[model samples]
Target: MTSATLGPLLAEARADGRALGAFNVITLEHAQAVAAGAARAGVPAVLQLSQNAVAHHGGELAPLAAALTALAHAAPVPLALHLDHLDDGPLGRRLLREAPEAGFGSVMFDGSALPAEENVAATAAAVAFGREHGLAVEAELGRIGGKPGDAHTPGVRTDPGEAAEFVAATGVAALAVAVGSSHAMTVREAALDQPLIAELRAAVGVPLVLHGSSGVPDEELRAAVRSGMTKINVGTALNVALTGAVRQRLVDEPGLVDPRRYLADGRTAMTETVARLLAVLHGAAPAVPSARALPADGISPRPR
Candidate 1:
């Protein structure tokens, strides 16, 4: 199936009263794995590339964009390519300008680390940029600590009143509110404030987004969706799966110099992780059909 725009995907998820899984893609392999997982689960998914990831790959988003767009078209389920966590003002503006042309469904302009007024101002700018490009915009309201190469600082939970004002000021398509979830957490121990989420939902008209969701337990994740979160971003869990798989592969085969072999293992592990997350987002059992169940032509079988 061809990829759909982010607006429609999030709108549909909201209409259906379910949260859409937005997985972070750090490499070409990660993009493929996320697509394959969505195909296997027969659910729509978003493949996102963080600004940090783009920087890590030498500040070129074109290669990863091309790969994700191709996978989006090839997948059995609807997919969306998103530019995630853009912090640098100039680079963020450039990506916001180039993303729609490059086939991205959405762009998340993160200015959470900035002062409240600056964050609101910058996010409003990004929202305006997104409007000109006819692309969806996601802006962060509260600080979710744990950026790459940083010490883990607990997130300062978002104030419902502030969140409402921020969304109104920015005209963002989605609002990512911090409800006690932190980035890069390997353990599922983040305590979510459902009451805050509910309050924010009441205050903010747009869909609520939860970042650093990998640390949120399954129960909390489900509760978040029930409470009003429309988009949940997962990163650390996928990174854990990918790295662990690669490490195990190398340990099992000590002299393996081929990048493809280890990367393939990592991809497989990431795919499985995505499948489980999709199942949870869909509120379905995790035993979904595998990718192999898709027809040779790459179309998934209709549900019985």
Candidate 2:
């Protein structure tokens, strides 16, 4: 399948009353498993590279960007590379200018930490750069409430009127609005404010994004899509899967010497995670895979 751009993928998913799933890639296994999972689900997905991911690989993105793009190109289903949650620092601005060439079809410029006016101006400049570069620019204003030693304010939420105003001022391709979900939640019980989501969707002209969505339950996710959310971002959930699988493999097979053995299981877990989430986004109940052997190629394998 060909690497795709956000415009067509968004249009296609919107037409089907489904939201696009964007999963973060922190490691090469994440990229490979996400691609294989999307292929198994037979849906397009965005393989996201976030600022934290850049730091994870080294303090630069070039090494990982090219490899992720190569994975997207080799994905069995249409996939796109996205730069997620990049700040407005020197490196951020430089990346904004170079992302298109780095094989990213979309980039999220996060000016959310800045004061209100500064956030607007920074986002507007990013929008301008994206406009000239033919890239889709995603913007986040304020914070989607969450906690991990209080990294983001736990109760702050996005106001619909403010969101509409920000959209008009910034010309962002999509907007991530804070409803009620918290980030990095291991439990699937975040109560989303459907009314607020509907209100924001009505006020904002662009597609609405639901970030920190791994904490959202299946029924809540379907309701969010029904209420007008168009893009769903999930991260910690996949990490949970990968880490758990790798840990279990090591425990169950103590003599396993090859790192590939545990890594393969981790990749398999993430592949299954991606496929299941795609099904949820498609408004279908997740199904258990039939008992069948998966191929052991470096690329994750799923029953076709």
Candidate 3:
């Protein structure tokens, strides 16, 4: 039950022509649900903490990161902690410095807001920190379509040649490319450029990551993986699923008032969603361990 880095797992996925699911953690329930889902799928998954999630907690990442690390220790399947979509350079550096203490195995230092040259420089600095800490580094090239200002403008897809150069310059272990997916889309109707994805796969040496994957349909996701996307990032889908479950729970039991009571349904719903997405990403249902193999609370049995 020891915690481990994401390098070997991502590399294995790329080699096997399968993809890993990286779910975003919003609350303690989210951490449990993600781990539980991954356990059910019998596949390793990444549990990510986004910058917005940090803002929600008043910028204190240590508490959540500690909880995720503890949960990872007792997870039935391998789980890696990742800091996702980090745009602030100072924050990214601080996270990298404290990553070992927080038990983060990898990070996605997002510099997509910067011009290409600046993005490379900033990301390369993050990569330097990763080298020092022995944690995997993931950087994005081209804007991934979802920022508030880009709604009206055409999406900036990542070019294969540029992707190759970016990887070489930054030395990132993973590269997230824009191939028609956007962040925070509630509807699952994003149209991906499959040919572009294949081209990036052939051009870039590192594993390709697909961000804003919640907007993609099941078949499209499978196609993206088949086209060489090794890591798929999902956030909004879990939020929508959890919120819908909570709303239904409230209506079904009007007397319910306790947060725990309402949140239980959300946890269940998220767990189900995670399992389904994991199954789709892996392309088959893996044989999970028996119920007794997992901790009752889906967290570490050892003392925190």
Candidate 4:
């Protein structure tokens, strides 16, 4: 864990003019691949388990969370476990109240589906819960949209002045803003409003987050970081890589029925993609701290 929190790394990224790559973890393979990639890159990484992913595992969190905690402990570079896209109030609240014990260091209280005022209220409550529980919290203000399974409607942009006010009212650690990126994009074609990103960076005090980064091109993602985005969230890109590799592996060896063989290839593919993404986000500079800086038990600083 390297005594790293999302806040300090984000603040450091903002100060250093780089962006941290936050990858979503769906299974043990996903966790291993992400951690392996980050270690290979020698940079700090965020391994996030999303609400949808939790649901896929029968709504149980303990086993997965525990495994990810162990993986973080054993990872060569710093890694943080985060609960991502927690939108449903009941489920989100429950996870906020319970997940700290399961080793979640942070949570994203997504309220983009609600009306603006209602969203702010829900996010404020979540922020309060996070503060009480000693967890770093993030919330989305504007609706970042996409083709399918996305939370918000399209064409909704974040207002800089309102964003500043929202931060004041919610006290969130970071804000995910809509700057032309959409979720579930298969291709890297989303055109971002660099000027708007810059404006939001200037208006908001906390580090800015860019969700659905899998849709953005490497150059555009780099440009977004340059425009002041500190954390970049990517998911679909890794899924694409993993599934593609699995398909290719099966085709190459039709008689191979072993799950481990196929899944190992998928993990390798995902690892390669994650390493590339990290390089794009932060270049070759090492972002992880020395192992000596972290606790011997692999637990880092907790908010209080």
Q: Which candidate is the best by lDDT?
A: 3
Model 3 TM: 0.91
Q: Whole-model lDDT, candidate 4?
A: 0.83
TM-scores for the candidates: 0.90, 0.90, 0.91, 0.90
Give per-residue CA lDDT, model 3, range 190-292, as digits (tens).
8899999999999999999999998887878889999999999999878876777777777777898999977887888888879988998988845543323
Residue-level lDDT of model 2, residues 1-304, one tens digit each, is: 6688876787777667789999998888999989999999998999998887787766677888889878888888889888988888977887787788888889999888788999999999999989898899999988776733333665567899999999999999899988878777656767789988889888988888999897787788889999989999999778877777777776777899998878888888899889998988887755543312122211222222
lDDT of 1 by residue, 86-180 (tens): 88577766777789888997999988778778888888888887888788999887667667643335656778888788888999999888788
lDDT (10s digit) by residue, model 4, range 93-163: 67777777888878999887788889889999888888887788999887788734555566678899999
**lDDT for 253 (candidate 2):** 77
Runs in model 3 lying further than 4 Å from the true structure: 285-304
Error of 4 at 290 (Å): 34
Looking at candidate 1, what is the lDDT of residue 222?
84
Worst 10 residues of 1 by lDDT: 295-304
TM-score of 4: 0.90
